[model samples]
Target: MILCVLVFVLSSTTLSQQHLSHPINFCSMASTCIHDGRGVCASSPDGCSRRSFLDQCDMYEYNCDYGTQFMTKVSNPCTDGQPDFLC
Candidate 1:
């Protein structure tokens, strides 16, 4: 049981790193008013809104930094694909 749990943790960590490695460029998307193919733009001049769309494939949040003109994610990409419509 312990071994199984350890393996799961390791795998999950590796997978999470894969998505974050490129660091989705929310700022670029926002500038162009686009998202990961399916994500609708729900960002504001100040930053992301409460109803902002999640990343199409990874389901990550698009966090923006108005001051720096940079963007990031509020959380790690969802391991399990969500919002089935896009999937």
Candidate 2:
């Protein structure tokens, strides 16, 4: 039971890291209106080319400066064929 609990705790932490709520693709961003977030990487004010596997392939959020955290559970495959949609 202890082992199981420990494993669950560890896994949960890792999962959180992969699914933190925030803006993505900062490098390719075309806007800088975003304020900040867990996954938000200081906006470059250029919108964002950033992608991430923060949430499941289909289930994710688009937190543009926390104004709106859009969530979806489906996504088109990246042109580069990255599973996480990261270029």
Candidate 3:
């Protein structure tokens, strides 16, 4: 019984480590490509604000967690038909 408990503990710790060490990325769009909970870097959307943006595309390191919220810039298609207004 003691050995079984130790094995279970070890397995759980390994799993937790794997979960925490995973990389996350930010995709301008949500998809399976951003799976694995790693640090995801995303580029500015089509109609993003250039004054406060990093670049057309960005892939930065980030932590993965349930409490983390990602805000994405969206271009309004009804706008000037160009990547002008951000939604």
Candidate 4:
């Protein structure tokens, strides 16, 4: 009985440690895609500012990284007046 209790305690501790070391990642479940060369212009949710991305996939990744909800703009807001640049 004592040996069984010891084995159960060790196994439970090992299982808990393994789970903590390898937490589940929900982001990896998102579909992967190849980014096209075409550029994408994304505008802030409030539309006060904008940024450019390498492509649509880049824009999506930026949103995911920042926990933002920026959407693609029809035109490049970065080029409307200021010199061509990326932000």
Best by TM-score, which number?
4
What local distance difference test score does each model get? 0.42, 0.38, 0.35, 0.63
Write model 4 residue lDDT over 1-87, tens digit each, in one string.
Answer: 999999999889878653313332313422474767578787776776678877767776776677666567753434665422443
Which candidate would rank higher by lDDT, 1 or 3?
1
How well does each candidate superpose onto the true structure, as a TM-score? Answer: 0.22, 0.23, 0.22, 0.51
Candidate 1 residue-wise lDDT, 1-84, digit = tens: 999999999889878753443555645545655345543333233443223345432223234443222233333322332432
Q: Which stretches of candidate 4 lie over 4 Å from their true place?
A: 1-31, 75-77, 82-87
Q: Give me the displacement of residue 40 in model 1, in angstroms.
A: 35
Backbone Cα, N, C clashes tallied per candidate: 0, 16, 12, 0
Order of candidate numbers by lDDT, starting with the best: 4, 1, 2, 3
**What is the alpha-carbon lDDT for the whole of candidate 3?**
0.35
Misplaced by over 4 Å in model 2 are: 18-87
Alpha-carbon error at 3 in model 2, in Å? 0.3
> Could you tell me which residue pairs clash in candidate 4?
none
Please estimate how well model 1 matches the true structure, expressed as its whole-model Cα lDDT.
0.42
Q: Give residue 49's lDDT in candidate 3 (0 to 100).
A: 29
On lDDT, the candidate that comes out on top is 4
lDDT of 2 by residue, 1-87 (tens): 999999999989877655433455422241433433233222213323334333331112244343333333234222433233332
